[model samples]
Target: MWSGEESSRLYALRRFVDVYPTITKPDRHVRFNEKMWTTTFVLIIYFAMTNVMLFGLSGQALDLFSGFRSIMAGASGTIMHLGIGPIVTGSIIMQLFAGAKI
Candidate 1:
């Protein structure tokens, strides 16, 4: 049905693919049990902290001075992102060593 209005669409096509005749608890917009919610919450907290730390009260302070400080601090963000690089690298290395790929 959506031909050229894809760019103007609100939600993605995949979400609209499965439709329920009636709205109930399971058919609600929000899925509370999913890991996406948890990841989104964590991202929000991380960005909030970064904003507060980087820009005290004035959002305009996100300029050269504050930017320099943030860069110098080597912001690996929270522990999860910090460890993710190493973990992914190690897993990839292990997989290659195990001859799992060409």
Candidate 2:
């Protein structure tokens, strides 16, 4: 009873899944100190990236999502323009797959 569009969508999703890489276990267990140091380093890098300005762009663009800045944990017009978008998108995809029992 599924429509043609639904079937086509399923086919596309199947093709994507076929090409997706399998998750591999980490080579070794991470110690607490190592994890903390890594976290600190990443945070420092993220903060530095957010502070870096975007070049070669006209200043005419407006940040409509300025209100959501606090929520996004990102500043506009920088490398963090779409702050945490990749992380959030990845989380959403993982949740969707988990919901689908994939």
Residue range with the least summed lDDT across 10 consecutive positions in model 1: 74-83
lDDT tens digits by residue: candidate 2, 1-102: 767776665676876887799988889998999999999999999898877778964447787878776775777777787457878999999999999999
The residue pairs in collision within model 2 are: none
Candidate 1: lDDT over CA atoms? 0.55
Candidate 1 residue 25 C-alpha distance from true site, Å: 28
Superposed Cα RMSD, model 2? 14.2
lDDT of 1 by residue, 1-102 (tens): 557756655656667657746555656565657768889998787665443433233434334444544654433333322335787898889999889655
| Per-candidate local distance difference test | 0.55, 0.80
> Model 1, which residues run further than 4 Å from truth?
1-33, 54-102
Q: How many collisions per candidate? A: 0, 0
**Model 1's TM-score against the true structure:** 0.23
